[model samples]
Target: MTAMEANTDEGVIDAHHHVWDLSVRDQEWITGPEVAPLRRDFLLADLKPEARASGVTATVLVQTIDIPEETPEFLAVAADSDLVAGVVGWTDLTSPDVTRALAALRERPGGEYLVGIRHQVQGESDPRWLVRPDVLRGLAAVAEAGLVYDLVVRPHQLAAAHEAARLLPRLTFVLDHAGKPPIASGELRPWADAVRLLASLPNTVCKLSGMVTEADRDRWSVEDLRPYADTVLDAFGPRRLMFGSDWPVCRLAATYAEVIDAARELTAALQPAERREVFTRTALRTYGMTFTGSQAPQEAPCA
Candidate 1:
């Protein structure tokens, strides 16, 4: 079945998740003791059972590194798997040839799975990186190609994100992890205020992701994630809000089922249709994802 012909009324569409191989290329960011658990490769096969058990019918494979070669590799992964319907890959947003690069990516195998582009904006020392003139031009090109840009910046950089989103109303800015709010500190003032400014834009949407990792990994509870979840729900509303597992990384804090269950509890007060918007429709619409049947065999040998 294809996305157009598949049943959209049920089944969770996990809008964000990742798969990596240490042998393919070094995941340079998987450094330091804090992230040591993630040093090994996590392939699609490992995610299959978890997603299936969680009732996740499809997912968007997001870029974990800024390397350009990784995008085509991820596209190849998506091409082989039924679980990944779309990809949020990366390219040099500062390169003068970015538009041609995007077109070139589209021409590669499984390039059609590319649905969005993202940068690790949170890593940049410059808080105003998103608004840089060169970056803005690349973003415009992303918009021109009909793909959304995922903002993965820290709280201090949100003002720049708001400015960029404001300047390009044609581009749909998907705020990944709701700007990675400071959930661990239990402080919401600055993050709340800054996120609202971005939410005020009509072209903006947000993902209820990364919260588990942001909170105290060892001691977090669903209640601990409520306020942050509630803030995004109130700011973006159900129509604009989408659910993402942020898997593997989320493993640092909660299991896949725990994350899914927490999301369900956080939005329990919403009407059923509203919850559906959060778990399913918003992702399908925002990412422009589509599905086709036929599962791929896993690479890992049976245990």
Candidate 2:
């Protein structure tokens, strides 16, 4: 049966979402009139019920800033929550002591929930930032620690992401938001080609998240997102694609339930097993996540 025909009984693993508190640290990125809605604190407590009602039994809490203190604090939050199964936190990729820093993070309380590391490479001025020697060394150390690396890149920076993934064959590289395609303008040239190139790498995966924010936030339709979503589905197939909410962030364009519904509509053409891959299996493997709820699927080794 097609995904649309499948029962909604299947559990979901929201591979990407974030939580932050302004009282602890200012989210300097949350500025300007367009982002005013995000200036307030987004705590896990605010997300739990909404997530659970949407069939999300587990979620990967992603990093929002470059702060050294945020990851440990997120780990602590994960330790206390039933919903957060994994964390993709941040650290300075260029720091000379990256390996030691990773080790120290692993030793912290709730550290075992640390599944991956992400840097705001999209914010870097250098176009080829990921391939830089120091950054590459840090990525290698991340691989050595048996962790995945999440790529949060702009469309223009995808080539560098491709090269970085090519350079690190052993590391599992997850492309967040399908490289943030140009859905707002309906442009699909280099973005589609670049995503195809990155997906050609055996070590990479792509998230079916953040597309709503990338589109016309005020009036986006599933049709507006189909081209980019179809491109990634064709390139990476179901096994390499996973679902992510990009929540609070997705709130810029859609509510959590609306985003989930849109994803279901987009993938309605796929078979039931393929749907499960996007909604469940891929995240289970990609992050090596361990879920605590009764609906959680059995753990599987990372592919």
Model 2 per-residue lDDT tens digits across residues 49-87: 998877877788999999899999999998887678888
Q: Which model scores highest in lDDT?
A: 2
Count of clashes in candidate 2: 0
**Candidate 2 least-lDDT 10 residues:** 1-10
lDDT tens digits by residue: candidate 1, 95-212: 9999999999988998888889999999999999999999999999999998999999999999999999999999999999888888888999899999998999999999998899
lDDT of 1: 0.86
TM-score of each: 0.93, 0.93
- List clash counts for every candidate, in order: 0, 0
Candidate 2 — which residues are off by over 4 angstroms?
1-10, 290-303
163: Cα error in model 1, Å: 0.3
